[model samples]
Target: MTKSGNVLQKINNNYDELSERYNFTILPRSTRWNSVNRLGFSSTYLIRQGRVIEAIEVAELYTEYQPKSWQAYESLAKAFEANEDNLQALKNVKIAVRLVDNEVNKSLLLAYINQGDRVNMQLRSVKSLTLICLMLFLMVLTACNNDSKLDFDAFVEKKLTDFLIEENAQVASIAIVNDKLNYQKQFGEFPDGTKPHHDTVYEIASITKTYTGLLLAKAVVDKKVQLDEDIRVYLQDGDYQNLQHLGKPITLRHLATHRSGLPQDFAYTSADIKSGKAFELFSNYSEAKFFEDLAQYQLTSMPGETFQYSNVGANLTGYILENVYNQPLSTLVAQLITEQSGEEHTRFRLEPSEISKITRGVDRNGKIAPLLSPHSFAEGGLTSTAASIADYMQYLLSTQAEEVLLSRTLLTETSSEHGHAFFWNTYEYHSANPMFYHSGGSIGTSTWLALYPKQKLGIFIATNVSANNTQGKLNDIANAIVEKYEQVGQSK
Candidate 1:
């Protein structure tokens, strides 16, 4: 057998393992293939040993396990042909041909099926062998094309270098697969010309929203907050009495999903947010001021009327969560996310040693931006190392500790058409697998994190300089990684 076939055989060798141990495993027993996952291997093995009845039974089980799998249908067709069930064999082979993705593969299988003389089928088996060889050749060529087009490590290095020249960014990024750190790289350096290590930290601006969303999901599971219930109960009555519009109160769901009908930001003007004073302004921006703004402000539409991106709404959600848990948002976040995800260096506030590892953010003009003050502790305020973020992402994609990770509950779609899940966005297309993503930007930094859970893939990119078009750049990098990930994973 060839290397790829050997890999598939090894996967079949470990077929009886439980689902939770699926990290980095070649073939995760997908939901549809759960019942007779390795039966294809067993059926082929048994058919060669002249165990026709046993092979037929196993092949039938394989078909039931994944009715849509063209391979399973084709295997069953072969088993039927071995058993002299020519009519059943023809029916199954036709179905297999119909279900195939590639036209070439389908045509080859159809030609193999049209050879009706079972007496000379062994001679025709040479055609089947040739078809397999051609199919494998095509797959190799396709994989090579995808690799050249979507070399993720190369793309990140190139993009980071471009940012260094164009945006003057000091950037670091990493990719994780199957709970292991696969790529760790950096470009440029701190203004003082210090090289960044794997432990170097960066501000993950609105990317903090996904962490906040995870907290909300955990709160629901803990019965600390009801997802669909109004958040007014957690807020002081006087502070939220006028928050409603036409008697419609915003729920916790509305706030997390950006449908809370709140404004995008506070009154922090450019003048107030001077280089070093931004943190002071954010910290001193009082609860009283927040309520006063809400009291005076008018809602143009009712809560949940539409999707409006709102930093205020997310921060308020964090604040209410603090109230409900009777703990600081920082502490709650540490316990709920950072600790659970095994991200030792990720937190809302960094200690002095942790601070030493962080790169200083440079403004677009190349001036060192003001270091974030302690008050910017929620919403867009998060500092984390690339390695830790990669580990956290792997933790999210892994099946282990799923109840605490809350991947399933968090991914329940609020808008299937739009593919919004909590604060994460999902990409839905016929040919593409689903992915969950979120991006963040602060004055001097930007970050994007995403997961293709089905493929057990995750990527994180962060830069010290906030570029003019960071989002577009992040999207391109992410798409490239996803394409590469799917190609490699599918081949395995």
Candidate 2:
């Protein structure tokens, strides 16, 4: 048997062991089918290995195990698509679409169906082509009619409402900024039955990394640090011999660009967070604790040669910034970012009055979740509101500040489609229309921020709910809004 076959056999034989090892019980109930998820992954892997028939067989097994699941049908559709069986792909995807419960999944399956239809059209009979053309004509006519009546604000409101209902989330805030427009809105009410307004605060989570990145840019501009300088120069108290790999030391840029060989986090794991252990663990975590973990850390790969999303690296950057400026991170944020941006409610620390304004966050299971602690302030602890984030977005869109500009500069190219600046992920960096964006997720909230420099467009979206696919949902909403905005602009 092939290696893949042997692996599949072993997984089948040790199903309970795999379930226990992976802690399948911690997953959302809807996604608790560990065998189905693994089978889908195996099918994708087999397809990538050029084992198309085996891939289809695995997908078939997935559907057999979870016949009613849209995900299973979707997986099978993908396998058939890979095998160039457009008819089968379309048939499976249609079923997937029918079975899908949420708008996000339905939207995805519809796209696949549309693509498959286009491909299958070439092979259709002349009569079938005529019918398809008739359908297209009607679709175009309906779209044109809808476009004539489209209100950007109403469209956005509907999208946000659908998202809230689909995710069973309580509240969300969104801000959009461009040269011609500044818009902000809050949707839904808090658990207390109080409606969230423009200034209602919620944890922005890892979006805080962008602020840290901007601070690093300021340090570079001020000549306080060099991008390629060995980070150990500032860690004089500890012997971090493990911070280097293959004679190359981790640099400030490596940390900023996620190319530093640091672990994802030192304080807690995903399981810990799911089990409510992370809150306890972080309660006592300090700068000293972080450094102690760093001293014992081993490099997994050569510095600047790998891309690992490391909150530890981001926090370390924050620490380094603090050391260089001789100021606390909170003070630095106040002086450098929020103050300059005129963001009144954006902060690492909140007062009692401000705390009262913070919205309650809900998790996937509809339970109220604990707000993020301040210990990970640099990495994921900042909280803000739609109004303040609007100001921040406008600040980013209009500012010509050297440090802000430097922060958006592509520091490392991870792929043709993806790169990294100071900490922001970059897309199409070498093209005329470059973009910088980041997504953040805490235990109870998720957020996404994106900046389109060429378009002078910036968007910030946050929800008081965290789920496995919250970021993807937000990205879809952002994309939809951007598309509609462009359509409106063109129409005007």
Candidate 3:
């Protein structure tokens, strides 16, 4: 019997071995020619079945069924490939890959295409090489399973993608490091399906805070700034004179931890936006303007009183850092994120200007929008690619990077729960998990970046669909992926 047919025979025989949901494996079992998730079983199915007309049906579903269920789509692509519609097949496959999250399945999908070395080679009948290669990839996934553990690489892919799909969201990329003797994989988009490439950029809304927060962590360790020092002391400018008289001081600790009594976002005064962009929040940015902003606004609660998640407070963090470093916040981020992390594609400076390259925040209907305004650079100015952000998180997992950016004592403080930071917020410290996390958003943008330092797991998820609050969606996906990876580690 052909290897493809044999491999299918074996998987069908032992389908019970696949992990379901949290266990990380999702190998569907079935009987007869119409095996369930058979499209996922092997690439051989495609060489024998790919055709064109059916592929169009899948594209139409992008608008109809939303972004889920890739099997119908992959089959359509397979039909196209079988019928010699290679270009059409490639195009259809892009959408299919986007719809899928299962790592094992996506890898199986790529088996036939990896034959790009001789795409021009013609075959009169079904080539035997295809069957051999296709079966091997399947066996590889099956082999990675030991006792009951799922493949680490596949687990990351499936969990994250499943989470995003669950959120009615999609991630452009999920960067991972699953060393071989295991799977090492990457999934998702760039400007043009490119590689070593820029496809993973998504509008990581609040994750912007994590980048700035890391810089603050570094600064506190450097002794250039103290957590307890009044931010007003750092800023000699009269623009912050209102802060000088707030009855209580707003310290760096309060700003970083978000315990300072600040609003979540700027609920600007009529004078500031009466005739201007009412929601164009960052249009009036200047040190003096900030003081005016502070003086004109009333403190809803006492400073440093309780935990409130104030974007205003976070932005103030950016301001304090910039003021102390004597540099622009974005520039500092360049040194902190890109230079330090050895990342090349990540940037906050938009093309020729300053545009976030990840997913640009989305509008009401999940259309791309802009994150144009923030009063200060530190609070919300960084825009990063998933790969770069993931790399940065991996850096935090390092004792080497930690020693540079922080002292053990300050790192403890940054991760500590100090009651409240700002607007109605409570910090949940995950000390046991040793997670470095932050969520961010700006109008139509949202993002989540987290790292389990001890576990050596880092996940950065960004979606282009903004104003949709992709934070929960991003985390759900990250958690799913992390769960799979941790399972693999524990199984070891």
Evaluated with lDDT, which candidate comes out highest? 2
Q: What are the per-residue Cα lDDT tens digits for candidate 1 across 384-436?
A: 88878876786677535533345334433445534566667666522255677
- Candidate 1: worst-modelled 10 consecutive residues by lDDT: 18-27
Query: What are the per-residue Cα lDDT tens digits for candidate 3 across 59-121?
Result: 332222222346656655565565675555555665564445455565656554455431222
Q: What value of lDDT does candidate 2 attain over all alpha carbons?
A: 0.77
TM-score of every candidate: 0.63, 0.68, 0.58
Best by TM-score: 2
List the lowest-lDDT window of 10 residues for candidate 2.
Answer: 23-32
Give residue 116's error in model 2 in angstroms.
61
Question: How accurate locally, in lDDT, is each candidate?
Answer: 0.66, 0.77, 0.52
**Clash number for each model:** 1, 0, 38
Residue 457's lDDT within candidate 3 is 58
lDDT by residue (43-133, candidate 2, tens digit) is 7677777877877887887776545467778778888878877567656765675556434455544544455542233336554555355
